[model samples]
Target chain A: MKRSERLVDMTKYLMERPHTLISLPFFAQRYGAAKSSISEDLAILKHTLAGNQDGILETVAGAAGGVRYIPYLGKEHAENYLEDLAVRVQDPKRILPGNFVYLSDILGNPQDLRQIGKLIATRYAYAKVDTVMTIETKGIALAQAVARYLNVPFVTARKRSKVTEGATVSVNYISSSLDRVSKMELPTRALPKGSNVLIVDDFMKGGGTLTGMQELVHEFEGSITGICVLCEADFDKEKLVSDYLSLIKIDQINQQEKVISSKPGNFLTETDFSRF
Target chain B: MKRSERLVDMTKYLMERPHTLISLPFFAQRYGAAKSSISEDLAILKHTLAGNQDGILETVAGAAGGVRYIPYLGKEHAENYLEDLAVRVQDPKRILPGNFVYLSDILGNPQDLRQIGKLIATRYAYAKVDTVMTIETKGIALAQAVARYLNVPFVTARKRSKVTEGATVSVNYISSSLDRVSKMELPTRALPKGSNVLIVDDFMKGGGTLTGMQELVHEFEGSITGICVLCEADFDKEKLVSDYLSLIKIDQINQQEKVISSKPGNFLTETDFSRF
Candidate 1:
């Protein structure tokens, strides 16, 4: 293939498989080009991605050297997205009964998920996350998105046991929002032993569900590398878990007054965007 | 930017926002290049994607015209993937109690989800699907994957009502697997009226859950564009629903014998790959 054609195909291939290394010989054989030419094409790809501040192409040097695409977004991009997300969360129409803010629409949106996933993956690009874990229903999407960017598998925990999944390990945690004890379970074979897990969720009220997931990870002998959520109820009761990250923090949600207020969470300040 | 850099950036940009039209003027302004140069750059991208039969760059004419990227795979590509998926499904260890096969690993895999999502999107690329719908738990990942490729929002139907989602529309259908009437609900604001929804699920036995989703679509005053599933049990009893596409068909699973059999479904014969 010609250089221009190779560049287009190469960019699409690398973007699809982020955090994966592709050896020079493999690209050379695929494009029927010389190793030196493949290196030059990669140089162009690296420079363009860096110039755009949307992704990073890391070149590993050694006998096992190759190129790895890291989904790294610039600070400006992350800040602008969080600002827009916070504004969107502040819509009065989203106020629900009992001070709950309706965010299902945002959670279901693909563009928003892509941005959110990219932002979260940027934070843990170097954290060595073996797998992304989330609970049933809402958190699955976020988990899948982050897993895609990180090039890893994701596992979901279920609240109710089902016969389809075979054997499962159950964990009980306080349902802080409901003021009751609830149980969540994960399939025995879903996760491997000693895996590094990154927990994610759509909404966190008292961090009960997050706690449940953490316990499940422990049961599997996996370590919790990080915890993140799309939205956190900052004004609610005390949280069970600290040291977690959130994209948006809801300060107030007046149901009768039909008002809501929110701001970007600590994810912005906690994340280091200087790599771009 | 040079032609090589422009090609790389343009390919990445278009791939990120599938099914969304981007006019030449927009690309010209973003790259600070002439309109003719932008057109040439897109031409290179279109040709490269076509050569690989991986994607389709469609051009619109006249005013309000631009280019849209359709995630498409050739017939051979789809066939090869499904064949490999069937072989993977044939693993004897996946056989579980009650003749059920464990597939959470495949469902949770990002790479497998990407291929499944792209194949399904190819089938519905021109179907004008307004939204993707699936039941809670297992189907959420498949729904999100397809929705992302189609650039549409996905809605999940919960098995039980939750206070977090506010008001919901409930539907009752016979659970073929359990042989009991079960209820599923979707938030009132989750889906809009008059949408063309594509229902998807992770597994189908009697297809009772799919029927419930179909009924829910009707209840919302929307149309059912199509139904797709990742796996279906062929040796099971009569199905409650037909006219659906499945990626893999499990013919039999004997837990005691440690045997499982499967093959590609009708999706391959149903899809037309000539567009590439």
Candidate 2:
């Protein structure tokens, strides 16, 4: 293939498989080009990605050296997206009963998920996250998005036991929103032992669910690398878990008055945006 | 920027926002290039993608016209992937109690999810899928994957009502495994009326869950575009839904003997992969 054609195809191939290394010889063979030419093509890809400040093409030097695409967003892009997301979260229509803010729309959005995924992956790009973990239903999307960007698998913990999952390890945590003890479980083989897990969720009330996931990681003999949520109910009761990050923070939600207020969370300030 | 750099950035940009139109002027301004130069760059992308038969750079005419990147895979690529997937699914270790096969590992895998998502998206690329729908727990990942490729939001139908979702519309379907009727519900605002929804799931024993999703879609006054599943239990009893596609077909799963067998499903034959 010509250099132009190779560049286009190479860019697409690398972007799809983030954090995966592709040897120069493999690209040379695929494009039927010389190794030196393949190196030149990669140089162009690396320079362009760095110029855009949203991605990086890391070159590994050694016998098994290759290029790895790292999905990341600049500080300006992260700040703008989270600020806009916070504003969108403030819509009065999203206020549900009992101070719960409806966020299914945002959780379901693909564009938002992509941005959120890149942001979270950026934080843990070098944290050695073996897998992303989240509770069933709502948190699955966030977990999958981050897992995709990090090029890792994600496991979901179920709220109820099902027959299809074979055997499971259950954990009980306080459901602060419902004010009751709730149980969550993960399949016995879903997560491997000693895996570095990054726990994520769609929403956090008092960090009860986060604690549940943290406990589940402990049960699996895995270490908790980090904890993150799409939204944290900052105005709610005291939190049970600390040392976490959130994309947005809900400060208030008036059900009777049909009003909601939020702003970007600690994720913005906590994240090291100096890399890009 | 040079044409090489422009091509790299443009490819990454278009791939990130599939099915969304980007006008020529927008690319021109972003790259600080002429409209004609932007057109040439897109033409190069279109030609390369067409040659690979894995993507399409569709151009629209007139004042509102632009370009769209449709994520697709060739017939050969689909066949190879499904065949390999079938081999992976036939592992004896995956056989569980009650003749169930353990596939949480594959479902949780990001690479497998990407291929499955692209293949399903290829099938329904032009089907006018307004939204993707799936039941809670296992199917959420598949739903999210397909939704991401189609650039559409996905809604998960919960087995039980949650306070966060507010009002919901419920439906009942037979739980073939349990031989009992079960209820599933989606929030009233989860899916808009008259949407063309594509239902997806991780596994289909008797397709009872799929039927429930179909009923939910109908309850919302939306049309069923199609139904797809990652695996279909062919050795089980009669299927509840006939018009569906599956990537892998499980022919047998003898729990006591610890043997499992599977092969590619009708999805390969059913898909019209003639469009490159």
Candidate 3:
């Protein structure tokens, strides 16, 4: 293959398996190129990603050295995307009954999912997340997107038990939005003990569902490294959890006036874009 | 940017948005290159993908001239993956009390989802599918994966409606497995009338859920393009739907003996790999 063809194929291969180590010799053998030639090809791929601030290619040195692609969006890119996303969220037609914002359309969208995934992947580029976790229905898409970018498995917490999943581990937490106790479960066979988990959700009104997920993660002998939500209903009366990050913060949703107020969340300022 | 850098960026850009057309002028502006230069970049990409039999780059000429990336996997790739998947599914440990095989691990896997998506996309690459549909819970991931490759919106049929989704279209069908009438619904805004929908699911015992989803699609004045399942249980005495494809077929699951028999299904034979 020519250098140009190799470069295109190499980029796709690395992007599909982020945070994975690929030895130089393996690439040489796969492409039938010399080791030195493979190294030069990678140099171009890494330099291009770094130049755009969308990704990082770490070239490990030593007897066990290789290249690892880290999905890290530059600070400027993250800010730009969040700003655009926030503006999109400000549409008045998205408002729903009881102060709930209708976001199913965006969540079901593949393009939006890609952008959201790349942004979330930026935050956890170095967190060493073993798995991405989310509770069922609304949160599954977010989890899947992040997992794809992070190149890890994502487990979904279920509200009801299903025969297809076999044995399960159950947990209960207060749903602050409804002021009632809610239960969620994970397939006992899904996550192994002592795994590092990143919890994500589509919407966080009072952080109730997120807390339930946190408890479930802990019960499995896993650690909750971080928590993030696509949208946080700031107008909600009370919050059940803190120390969380949101991509877009909904400060107000005026149903009578058909208006909404939102902006980029603390994610932009909190993330360490300097990893490059 | 040099040709090498351009190829790397183009691959990433096109991979991120599969099956969506990007005008030549858009790429030219993004890369600060001329239209002729952009055409060369796409030529290299299309040629590389064709040689690998991993993707298709459809070009539209004339005033709306552009390129679109179609995620495609050849027949050999499908057979190899499904055969390997079948061997893994034969593990007796996956059998549960009611003869249900545990497959949450595969469903939640990113690598598995990517391959499954490519294989299904190859079958329907020319089907003119406007949307991919699946019933909620376990099937969402499969639907999203296929939709991502096809560059279409995925709509989930919910067993119960939520206030956040606004209005919905509901349908009733006989749950063959449970032998009872069951209801399913799709949000009114999820799909457009006169659209072509490709239905997908994670598992199929009697395909009762699929029938319900098909009915809901019809209620919206849409047509069912095709039906696909990740796994189909042949042990079921009767099936409610036909003309469906399965990635793997579970021939048997004996709970008493803790045995499972599975193999690649008719998907491989039914699909036409000659498109490449």
lDDT scores of the candidates, listed in order:
0.92, 0.92, 0.89
Candidate 2 chain B, run of 10 with poorest lDDT: B95-104
DockQ of each: 0.82, 0.82, 0.77
As for TM-score, the candidate ahead, 2 or 3, is: 2
The superposed Cα distance between candidate 2 and the true structure at residue B236, in angstroms, equals 1.4
lDDT of 2 by residue, B1-276 (tens): 999999999999999999999999999999899999999899999999999888999999989999999998999999999999999999988887777788888888889999999999999998989999999888888999999999999999988777778899999999887889999999898899999999999988998888999999999999999999999999899999999999899998888887889999999999999878
**Across all candidates, what is each one's fraction of true contacts kept?**
0.84, 0.85, 0.81
Query: Could you give the C-alpha RMSD of every candidate to the true structure, in order shown?
Result: 0.9, 1.1, 1.4
* Chain B vs. true chain B: TM-score per candidate: 0.99, 0.98, 0.96
**What TM-score would every model get versus the actual structure?**
0.99, 0.98, 0.97
Cα-based lDDT at residue A46, candidate 3: 94
In model 1, where do residues sit more than 4 Å from their true spots? none
Give lDDT: candidate 2, residue B71: 94
Candidates in descending DockQ order: 2, 1, 3
Question: Which candidate has the top score in TM-score?
Answer: 1
For model 2, give the interface RMSD.
1.1
Once fitted onto the true fold, the runs of candidate 3 whose alpha carbons sit more than 4 angstroms away are: none
Candidate 3 lDDT over residue span A226-260, tens digit each: 99999999988678888899999999999999999
Candidate 2 steric clashes: 0
